[model samples]
Target chain A: MAHSTTLEPTATPATYTDAPRTGTWDGGNEPFKASYGKLMMWFFLLSDAFTFGAFLTAYGMIRHKHGVFTGTAKQFYFSTAHWPIPEKVFNAFPGLHGDLPLAFVALMTMILIFSSVTMVLAVEAGHRMDKADVQKWLLWTILFGSMFLSSQAWEWSHFIGGHEEGTRMADGTLMFGANLAMNQYGPPLFGDLFFFITGFHGTHVFSGVCLLVWCFIATTNGTFEKRGHYEMVEKIGLYWHFVDLVWVFVFTFFYLV
Target chain B: MSAHAAEAEHAYVPGEIAKPNTAWIWKTFWVLVAITALEFVIAFTLTSPDWRTFRNSIFIVLTILKAFFIVGEFMHLKHEVKSLIWTVLVPTSLLIWLVVALVTEGSFIGEVLSHMFT
Candidate 1:
């Protein structure tokens, strides 16, 4: 059947069995030529962005109301303030613990960003149809992603376990360690939001790593080679970069601010 | 002959698959590293509470800058069709506006609570 150039539908006789292609939205050809998988991925990421934004916005509201701990070492030991400073709350390293504020988190951020670079390289290699290069870069990306996950696990353990003892309240109760109900750090909400936001981001990183593994396996086995397209690598690269983008905002609002 | 038949008869040559140059990737990586280092320097060096608001603004700006690079270059969103780009960016922007409104109302509620309790 002949296809019409315009998108409008045409009038036809009732007896006609085969209708002409109208180039309308009913057809499978997308104006963007975006694959169904990639377009759906974009929509999914958009909704996920709203979820994270709502969480962070709620965090901002609570933080603004309660205020943060502004006491120093001198006041911290003597004063009875409940809120704790963020840097003080997250100052411990894995081995060394001499007030290395923001050091560990900064390292984790670098590792995640570097993994993003490797993902970009993988997509570029896929563009060139270099299967070996794509495999190598994907491996590197997975390694860095796993390293970042491990770093987060260590940080969570250190926080939940507590290093040195925190301040004792006047009620003869020791205020140490963090949980959903209570936290040694500033407010209880502070710990709750930290776990929620960072945990969610970590889960994304884990998922991205899994996707990379699949892509790597597919590349090595010549699946994309047979299809003669490397767009899968590009699609996964978009998700990986989006993960890194969200972390940028999380680090800014949660840690730096 | 029909157009489809003519097109099918042509050689199945692949698109340009020349050796990829990776200089641009490293350039973006170094840019991100430099911005992060600057953030750390600002974080540790500026200890005075007097500069708290100023420092916080710096952090936000730097964070957005990093996001631009990651989304634009790494994800190749900048190279996509304008309509496709808008499809992803415009809706997400409404979420940002929601954040501003919610936080403002939240702080106002805090003020009301404090007035009643104090």
Candidate 2:
């Protein structure tokens, strides 16, 4: 429709009807209609982008309305008025913990960042048609992705475990939502939003790990190598990079903002 | 019938780097990293009631810049013809606009809530 209904053929596209439906987005054409995989991947990314945008926007709206102080956020467990700050809450250590700063989450962030790097490396390996390199980088990317997922698991546990000073409702009454408001560390909305946004993202990461693992497994068994190129790597790379990109926004909005 | 079905109409080369310029990749990476760092620094250093507005404006600009490089270089949005570029950017821009409108409505509710309940 785009070409037929339109007058000019701006870019030349090559058709490979014989190729397997291996991707929704990946390398198909150097400049024309990308492979079905890459196209689909972009569609997925676009939908995902909207989902994330919606969440962050809602979070912002809530923050603007309820960001003010109802009372001195008091720490119930620690016996202090300093309730759990977002940075402080996420920063603490697990075992040898002593008022650390963004320890676990920071580690998780690094893991994700490394995974992003590994993903690019894998894509590069794909470009070279180096199966060994593709396998190596992709495996590293998968492992790091798994590690990030685990770290997120730990973060969730800590959040659900409940903090000292919890959430204060609109009535100025402090109530526990089963560690609902005053979680194991700080405010309830912190956990509420943390779980809602990051949890959803964590699900995506988990799924991505599964996808990466599948791709890596295929790499070992000589799938992409058999096909004679690394478009697979780039296809998944796009998704991986998109995930990393989304996290940057989530971190900025939920943490720093 | 689908645009994709006209695949025979367009020639394709798989995994071929459009620019074939490694130099641009490295240069773009450095520029992107530098801009990201600057964004972080400005986010931390600024302090004003207009801080929210200023920070938001800067963050958005930085985000758009970063997105451009990623799309242009990494995702190869630039390699495609101008029509393709316009097709993608127009839709994505419209999506962002939709989100912005929804969020503004949410903020309005927040304002009303603050007045009634606060």
Candidate 3:
């Protein structure tokens, strides 16, 4: 919702890049944080940027170690024993469970994406000082965010609640997934790594939902309005967008590419 | 290159915010969504080797486009000062390179072990 207007400088930090705005900040403060709000946004984005970079790098490391873990049509997975395709393992449907192709996860992805959009709109509304617009969009943002968290919880339960396929070992513990002896899906590391990466992501999404809820309640309580600015929208917008940006990377590496 | 660079430099006079058209932004969103749908479709439907390659290419391109839109529009990177532009994209680019390099190394290790063990 950034207005395409003549860039005006209004007491922003001198470091505020892009063309200098025509407006100037008269409220004498440290130059860098012309608006403490925008500076805070930058700070949040930087920290979140590091978190995503770490996760994606770790994903790349693990995924690279595995050599062609997927096999189509039930053929042997690879030269070694094969692993079940991700498509197969992740294929779960709610009521229509007999046969489906990852519908639930797909729905979750959509909700997250939609939430990202709504959050942006909320921020835009903030820029315009339109409290009503902010409220409407932020409410949608909260709803979608909460739905995503619930969907993730369902997904995790389905994953962890399911039984391990292998029979009991000498000690009577069922050996499931890939391991040195059992070569189900190429290697045991696949399940460990898969759960770790997606689990980490899901945890972040959960935290993001909490933050969004806080923002929603604050908005409802007229917090931003009282502050006389919607910088909170912008700050929360940065976090929301980071969640989405990470998801795009996750979708590419984990699901598609 | 000079002409483009000079044009970019010349157009970037400070003060007035550059007002990109709203309609075009809407159009971009529609195009972005269409491409995303197409990406998922191609992902589900195509399995041929060449098709997979093409699909992968398209998927990456579309993802980049989607990211560009989010940054350029929603994050308002386009409106940010040039230094801000550098601050954001430079880190992102470095991270991408780092991922590529790390993956390449891991894949290479697999290739070596693949040959030796087999």
| Candidate order (DockQ) | 1, 3, 2
* lDDT for each residue of candidate 1 in A1-257, tens digit (9 for 90 to 100): 88978788678677564665556665846766577888887888888888888888887777776644454433553223344556777787888959888888998999999999999888877777778889999999999999999999998998887647775655778877778876677667777988999999999999998999999999999999888878899889988988888888888888777
Candidate 1 has an lDDT of: 0.80
- lDDT over C-alpha atoms for residue B10 of model 1: 38
Question: What interface RMSD does every candidate have?
Answer: 3.2, 5.4, 5.6
Candidate 2 wrong stretches, greater than 4 Å: A1-31, A69-85, A95-104, A163-190, B1-44, B47-50
Give the per-residue lDDT of model 3 (tens digit) for A72-171.
Answer: 4345322222334455556676556553555676777778777877777677556555667778888898899888877777776665554235434445
lDDT at A196, model 1? 95
lDDT of 3 by residue, B20-118 (tens): 223433454566567667767876787554465576777778788878876666666666567767777777677878777888887887778768956
**Residue range B1-118, candidate 2, lDDT tens digits:** 1222232233335544332223444566676667766765774476343465677777777767776766666566666567667866776677667657766776687678658856
Ranking by TM-score: 1, 3, 2
Off by over 4 Å in 3: A1-34, A69-84, A162-186, B1-29, B49-51, B115-118
Which pairs in model 1 have colliding backbones?
A: A84-A186
Best by lDDT: 1
If you assessed candidate 1 against the hidden native complex, which CAPRI class would it receive? acceptable
